[model samples]
Target: MADDYIIRTEGLTKQFKGFVAVRDVTLNVRRGTIHALIGPNGAGKTTVFNLVTKFLEPSAGRIVYNGDDITGSKPADIALKGMVRSFQISAVFPHLSVLENVRIALQRPTGLSFRFWKPDSVLDGLNDKARTLLRDVGLEEFEPVMAGELPYGRKRALEIATTLALDPELMLLDEPMAGMGHEDISRVSALIKTVAKNRTVLMVEHNLNVVSDLSDTITVLQRGEILAEGTYDEVSANPDVREAYMGTGHD
Candidate 1:
């Protein structure tokens, strides 16, 4: 049963000048499921994410991934272990074409990341795989377009495509649907679902509807600690969750 969990944290805590940002939080992300973390502003969602991904060190805690204690691992180390985090903002080379951006991402796994001096033809071998990722994210039509020229929503889709190029086993998405209209949200939501079929996803999102639709499990945080966690229906019905998350008039 231990193998069922891809990542787990025990007594995770973080502090800044004696101010506790995350306190004794324990989380278990199951293998092959979409897990969501949601909370109000300053609820420490990002802090927890940083800690888990090893961008920030925990003051007290242990992070275990695939049965290994990775509490002391670096960000790149964790990434090499198949846990990769996509940034909250779109991260792609503006000057590059959409296909180029994904080709660069694919280079890392092929030992070509720092070989900038290599002829462009050396990267041509990566184009087919990059195009496949673009098609996977529904951006094949825009492959030749400048990444900066694409609309905002499409940029996010491009970002996802690049992340997928890394071949992450567990993808950590930070607000994958942060800024988008209804249509973009719908498209990206479906893409997330399709990509999740073979890999696990752990996302921090503010959109309750998106969370409700995609998450197999949800964890609610408040004041740097877990307030409630369960399926959407279970947490939505809790009186405390209603008061804290949905507010008094939300019913």
Candidate 2:
């Protein structure tokens, strides 16, 4: 049963300058599931993400990924272990074409990373694979376009394409639907679902509608602790969860 989970945190906690951000949290993400972590602002959602991804060292507790204890691992180390994360902000090279951006991501696995001096032809081998990833995220038409020239939603799609190029087994998405209109939210939500069919996803999201539609399970955090976790229907009906998250008018 333990092997069913791709990542697990036991008694995870974080402190900043004597202030506790996450406290005694034990989270489990099953393989091949879309799990959403939702809470109001300042609920330590991002802090939990940082701890799991090794962006910030846990003040106390342990993190296990794929049966290995990785509490003391660095961010890059986790990434190398098939755990890749995307930031809340769009993180694409502004000047690069969409195809070039994904090709760059593909380079790391081929031992060509940072060898910018290698002739452009050296990277031509990566183009077909990059184009396939672009088509996967519905950006095949934008491959020749500049990443920065994309509209907000398209840029997010490009970011997903680049993230996919890394061949991540566990993808951590931080606020993937922030600052979007209704249409953009619908588009990206569909993309997340498509990409998550085979791999696992753990996302920190504020949009309950998106969470309800896509999440296989939901974990609700409040004041740096898990308030409740279950299906969207189960947690939505809990009075305590309603008061702490939905009652506050958070969608």
Candidate 3:
């Protein structure tokens, strides 16, 4: 909230029984910028995400979004505030056509009662907007394709389109490049850049190359705490980060 930051966490910490997974972390994600969270395994990158998304509650700390305190808010509550997370507990029906998947997402904000139960024709009115979203994500050609049948990278694109349907001001992605081949990685990386033009993106990704190329700011974690924070060059040049990755031999 301070100085255009869309989300900020102060003194964030989490523990399981007696073991701490995240500790006294303070992070700020600037609006309309791509921020990456990176660390070796067990560094608590995912835990920080889980806490922010409200999938897990922090043992101590506060989460602020757009200058409002949302630490005690529910997952749905934060999502409604335009902080939609990719892989957002929203299910994409595998059997549905890609367009249909996006259409469902487009219908989410209506708060209509059992609207999905209505006849399929009832959704014709939304096709244009859904198609526009498809075009926005480069999934226009695959609109008719079954979501389950699309190639891996295109499927990720569709998932992004669905999230975009909610019109989020801030987007959180958990491993946007996970399980991607070289080609898919490039494609999805480009798509993420395109989609992030007017929106803020916060992602947890292991592909440091993608982070190097895409992140406006990078935050590095180690043993459940922040070790480095800066642009790609700064974080990559940090001796502590080099030691954490190479000395510990964690990929």
Which candidate number would show the highest lDDT if scored against the true structure?
A: 2
Runs with alpha carbons beyond 4 Å of true place in candidate 3 = 88-91, 247-251
Tell me the tens digit of each residue's lDDT in model 1 across 209-237.
67787899989888899988999888777
lDDT of 3 by residue, 1-251 (tens): 29689999999999999999999999999988999999988899999999999999999999999999999999999888999998623347889899989988888887643376889898888899999999988989998898989877788888899999999999999887777898988888888999899999999975466778898999999999999999988988789998888844233
Instruction: Name the regions of candidate 1 deviating beyond 4 angstroms.
Output: 248-251
User: Backbone clashes in each candidate structure, one number apiece?
Assistant: 0, 0, 0
| TM-scores, all models, native as reference | 0.96, 0.97, 0.95
| TM-score for candidate 1 | 0.96
Model 3: lDDT of residue 150 = 86
Off by over 4 Å in 2: 246-251
- Name the better of 2 and 3 by lDDT: 2
lDDT of each: 0.89, 0.92, 0.88
By lDDT rank, best first, the candidates go: 2, 1, 3
- Candidate 3, which ten residues in sequence have the lowest lDDT sum? 242-251
Per-prediction CA RMSD (Å)? 1.5, 1.2, 2.1
